[model samples]
Target: MAQNVTRAGKSRTDFRDAIQPFLAPSLREKCATVLAGSVPGLEEIRIRCGRPLMAIGGNGDFFITPQGTISQSPAQAYLPDREDLDRSLQLLGQGSAYALEEQLRSGYITLPGGHRVGLCGKTLVESGRVMRLINISGLNYRLARAIKGLADPITRYIVVGGKPAHTLIVSPPRAGKTTLLRDLVRQFSVGIAELGFPGVKVGLVDERSEVAACYGGVPQMDVGFRTDVLDSCPKAEGILMLIRSMSPQVIATDELGGRKDIEAVEELISAGASLFTTAHGSDPEDLRGRPGLAALMEWKVFERYIFLGRSLGIGTVEKLTDRNLGSLINDKFVLRPRPGSGD
Candidate 1:
């Protein structure tokens, strides 16, 4: 029998160790205090100059008070000042903002543990191009996490006849599409022992630096021992490059919607490399409405379509269908808990 895989414990240790060190001392203390208690399903930490410190979690968005308590009233929350933002920026840049010029121009920095700090500020435009960001105003710290075995239930549908099927994961924003895709990459690269599949060479094009979350060319998240990542590279170019150079058995990338991206997907298909990718949509009609994606659907490019949503909490596999969009299962699939989880 295939043993049921349980959801991993939600711990804030990764966030505390990886992200807190870069926060301003005072702000760090407040965050640490809030995290010292039960985990809040924390997803994002938003800090804006002269604004209350805000955190977004599974439950919803809430403000963080100076005493490290969650507050519904923003008026009572701790307000970060100019100095706090300045000091935090310096720490994030390691005392040198100029050193992160390229990342700043791109408006985000990938931290050590795959955590990304998004920057929004005044821009220095030269010839209609943003040279760099200046007078930083806000920062959104998106915590990166890996839920091992999260893809266990869907792996069987993904792999058929000893090979990965061309699959497209559909989900709205924050609906766990990226998280699910990340786990899928890890499983395919490491191989699913329960399904008698061996690990294969997997190429990952991290266009947004999210899937693999590479920092300084090293993947902080576990994508599997056999995965090769192309960090911060465009999907179209990176896909073709991986096919010619790495000869990956499967090529995974995030968000496919552009004309060039579709063309590249064609190349990947022609080359006989399996594909694992995601798109921002709730259903098949949403995909058919898009010009680029509509063509692929007409051609039946993907063999399996997995729809995800938050109806049963994040990472919920709402539905699974075959190429023809016919239901593959009669009922909503629920993740089984491991023995003694007490759920």
Candidate 2:
């Protein structure tokens, strides 16, 4: 916390100016984590209040300092220079935002789950082509991870013959579904012989670095030695690409929607790759009732759907539903439970 050199009085304004929308105390800890190169499971940096902890690392090597000190490298700080912006623009022009993102991640960068940075700029499209973007502004450095046992909450519900079923995890906003998915990836990745499946070959479609955070063609997170991730590719294209090349036993992704993505899900399942995904919804009905997910429900694309929520400020397993079982929660229509069919 003392890392903030600014004092009270006029220094408060300077602190506000320098600080990136978070308190100095938390920033110091985040800064330290970023410098460390690898942040452990489920860490993230967000904008305003809410999650207490803020954003984190990308799938690239983090530097605390661009220029090395007599004892260490320079600490990570925001880069708003036009020279850096120029480089970003040039790289982006070639549809190489991933490369540009890697360049910006030189030092003191945050990396939770080995996740990479989220960049923003003006769109550069021409005649149905997304050429690149210009005027880079605002950076969202993400932490990547493969936290073992993150799926423990639903560990009891997901197993089918000792292996987690073809599962769909659902949550709203930031209820930790991706975080939970990240955990499942780790669990599946474990090189276990007795887990029924020996050395599961897992494929992670991390278009947004949700699992297997990758930076510059290298994985920043340990998503299991058996895992292969397609970072930054469109979800549908990435799925097709994985099936074509990776020969995966399981395919994992975050935030599913769109006809193309659903089609890919169907295609993969047809080939025998179990699909795991998350979407922004609170319950199974909320997901099933949605126009997009309704088709998947009709096709029974997912064997299980895990609903997540925060209970008393801690993440909780709110519900789990199957096509036959209907609502796993005691009360589906209301938050409080009522007399149920389970007796």
In candidate 2, what are the lDDT values of residues 1-343, reduced to their tens digit? 0111111111223322323232233244444434332332223433222112233322212333222211122234332344443443343334454654433333122232243445555666669765654455544443332334445445555557765578888777656677678667766777433345455788899877556656456765556778888876788999999999999988998988888898898889887888888888876667777666788887777778777776533246677787553666563221111122001
Clashing pairs in model 1, backbone N/Cα/C closer than 3 A: none
- Single out the weakest 10-residue window by summed lDDT for candidate 1: 1-10
Give lDDT tens digits, candidate 1, residues 68-167. 8888899989999999899999999998877999888989999987889999999999999999999999999988766766677788888878899999
Query: What TM-score does candidate 2 reach?
Result: 0.63
Model 2 gets an lDDT of 0.56
lDDT of 1 at 52: 90
Per-candidate TM-score against the hidden true structure? 0.92, 0.63
Q: What is the C-alpha lDDT of each candidate?
A: 0.85, 0.56
| Sliding window of 10 residues with minimal summed lDDT for model 2 | 1-10
Predicted structure with the largest TM-score when compared to the true one: 1
Model 2 bad stretches (over 4 Å): 1-115, 128-130, 191-197, 325-343
Model 1 has an lDDT value of 0.85
Give the clash count for model 2: 27
